[model samples]
Every structure is written in structure tokens, then in C-alpha cells.
Target: MFSNEEMRDMVCVYSTENFNGRRAHRIYLEMYPNRRQPDFKIFKNLYDRLGETGSFHHKRDSAGRPKTLNSEQEEEILVRVAENPELSTRRISMETGVSKSTVWKTLNKEGLHPYHFTPVQNLLQTDFPARQDFAHFCRLQQNADPMFLNKVLFTDEATFTRRGVFNFRNKHAWDLENPHLVSERHFQHEFKIKVWCGLIDNYLLGPFELPPNLNGKLYLEFLQTQLPNYLDDLPL
Candidate 1:
């Protein structure tokens, strides 16, 4: 590898005559006939990109499968991932002092795969007891009666909107060119509607539209008035 100082000297030599890359490269060849020089294409691209400092830039290794991680580094990266499954490839790269691509390759070679972070509603410590109680109740009911599910009513409320959110990491569009192209959405003016529904046995009921800023009174009214109408009209 040429030192940075040697690269500066080379740049000076190439730029002395204000010559184009091809002529400079020819001149360079004549000057150092015994030294192996980069291809004309590479030299041209470097000059076009870096100008007078082209030779100061290190040459990239385009040869097949250049090794970035040694056995020890590979093991260290694996251990880092094993300790923290949530560590992103970028984070792993920073921690292990390697490029993100190297970290990713190391993980894949060891049968590990990258995955996007999944979003979920956060539950507090207090919520766990309620969840456990609901699970226990369901288990007991299921144990007591084989047809327990048939007698139960399941209800939920949801919102519909003109806008939607998605994880770009989990989505892909394949095309001839760069397949990882991104799409931007504009939602300056938005509209949404809230709805409630219930299901029992073969009955799928009321996607009833709800008013804005629903409270206990509105919910109780819905349970008392709209829910009964749906239940009364249940299929025999």
C-alpha cells in the first residue's frame, strides 16, 4: 500500500500538466514502468471523482469475497448478538469495530438473519395480572364446557383512516433497477372514523360507527341500545 505522502506526490505528477486522466495515466505508466498501476477505467473514475487527490484515495478490493472479519472477530460479533438479540446490524458494527455489511455477513454465515423491529402496544406491570386473570378465566371456562366458545361474545373497537403507517424495512418492490426505492406519502388533511363490533357463534355484528371523543356514557349507551338490536336479530 502506498503512503498518503506518496499518493500526494503521484497526484502532483498527474496534475502538473493539467492533463486528462487517460493522458496522465499514459504519462504515469511511462514514468513508473516497473510498478503495477490501476486500470485506465479505474484511474479515470478516480480522477473524475477525486480530482487532484485521486491517488490519495485507497483502492477498493473488488476481488471475490474480500475477508473483513477474522475468526476471532467473527466469534466476538456472534457473542455480541447472542447477548442482545435486539442489537441492530449498525449497532453491532459499531460495537465490533467492523463495517455494517461485515457484521451482517458474519451473522448470516452463522445462520442468523436480520429482522425489522415489530411494533406492539406497551403493557405495564399492572396489566400482566389482568392478562393472567383473563387467561385463567378462559382456561377454566374452556375446561368446564367444551362448547364454551360458542356462548362467549368477543367485542372490540377499531379506527379507520385515510392514512396508514408501515415499516419500510419490511417491504420491498422488485424492479430492474434499484429495487429498494422508497415511497413518500402526504397526509396533510386527514379523516378517520371509529367503530365497534361484536361476534358470537355464527353471528358477525355491528360495525357501528361511533361519535368523536367517546366516553363511558356513550359506550354504555351503545351497549344498552345498539348491541341489543343486533343480538335480537341474531340468526336462528
Candidate 2:
């Protein structure tokens, strides 16, 4: 009864098998009545003794629908597809001894969906080999001024989610939103965010927010906040 194949067979054959096999076993034990699977074993005795006695009643779930096969079959189909992408579900069911309908339901339920993933393309970041040359340039600067330039420190700030200035460039309307009306007065959005930083001969600086209205006034105030912290943390 504990074995999966037997349990599946039990559930397949008996409408109430699931409750009796797993859950009712516990309840029956606690009732101070019968021991072991005697409650289940009574099915045969009662069939012989009563022989379709219209007296028997079952507490079935409402709507009286036939049981859909357990999720096990659906799960099997999912494993089959992942294990061998070449085998279509029908072919898999044929070979593995399960029904095509079961396989179909499995695919839909498990979302064995086929889709595509586009690789991101960044031209500037594409030149991974140029990393060596960049390091070489930094080394040359270090040799040029050993004491002072070697003291140069570098730091960076990274924000996980950032708002983009304009989102309309790449945005698409799922359904035509006024295919004719193009007005900036009724549109707004912020898309992706990014990391920013700066560096000099013997100093480094920020990826901090510049502010919504980044002008001389706002820039000066931001500088004021960063300058003192930078000075304190600056390596002598």
C-alpha cells in the first residue's frame, strides 16, 4: 500500500482509495476500533456479505464528476519531455505506457512550453579581450608615479532597480493606443536602471544619484554631501 504503483492502482480502481490508503489509515488507528488495514480489508467482506446492498452510500465530491487521473501522470510526462526534448509527448506516451490525453494534460499543466531566449548584445562590453589592455594602461600609470598614483583608490556604487529617463522608445502598445495620436502630454514611464562611477589619478568617486533636476544648484549640493565623506575615507 505504501508503494507508489500499488497506490496508483488503488486510486485508479477505487473512488475512495486515496482517503482510505493514506488519510483514513491514521483516523482508523486513532478511533480505538480496528488495527492495521482491516477497515480497508472489509471492502471485500462487505461485498460478499451485502452484495451491492443499496444501503451503502459514498460521500463523493459534489458535481459527481469522474476522477481525473492524479497529477502523477502529468508529472511523468514533464520528466519525459525534460529528459528527452526530441521525443514528442505522443511518442513518449506510446513508449512509456501512458495515455496521450494524460500526456497532453501533463504538458498543459506543467507548461512544457517552447519559447526562445534572445542573447543580450552589448558592443562596448563585447570586447572581453580588451580587459588585458585596460589593465596594462592602469599599470603604466602606476609605474609612472609609484608613490602617489599607487595610492589611487577606486570604488563604485550599484543600484539594483533604476528608472529610465524615457521608456517610449522601446515600448510597444499591446493593442493600438490611438494609432494616430502621438502626444507627450499623455505619456510617461521609467524603465531600467544602471550603475555609475568615476575615477581620477589618486581618487575615485560616485555612482550616487545626481537628482531629478540635475543642474548647477543640485549638482553643487550633491557634491557637498559626497566631498566630506570621500575626504574622510580617502587613503593617505
Who wins the TM-score comparison? 1
lDDT of every predicted structure (CA atoms) = 0.67, 0.49
What are the clash counts of all predictions, listed in order?
0, 0
Q: Write the per-residue lDDT of candidate 2 for residues 31-98, one digit (tens) a residue.
A: 43332232243333233323444322222233422225443333334544654566775686665466
- What is the TM-score (0 to 1) of candidate 1? 0.61
Over 14-131, each residue of candidate 1 has an lDDT whose tens digit, in order, gives 5774746567667777887765453333333434445554433433333443346654455456645654677898777666577788887877876778666677999999999999
Worst 10 residues of 1 by lDDT: 38-47
Residue 172's lDDT within candidate 1 is 80
Instruction: Give model 2 RMSD, 1 decimal.
Output: 17.9
Kindly provide the TM-score of model 2 when superposed on the true structure, using C-alpha atoms.
Answer: 0.22
TM-score of each: 0.61, 0.22
Candidate 1 Cα errors over 4 Å, as ranges? 1-66, 177-188
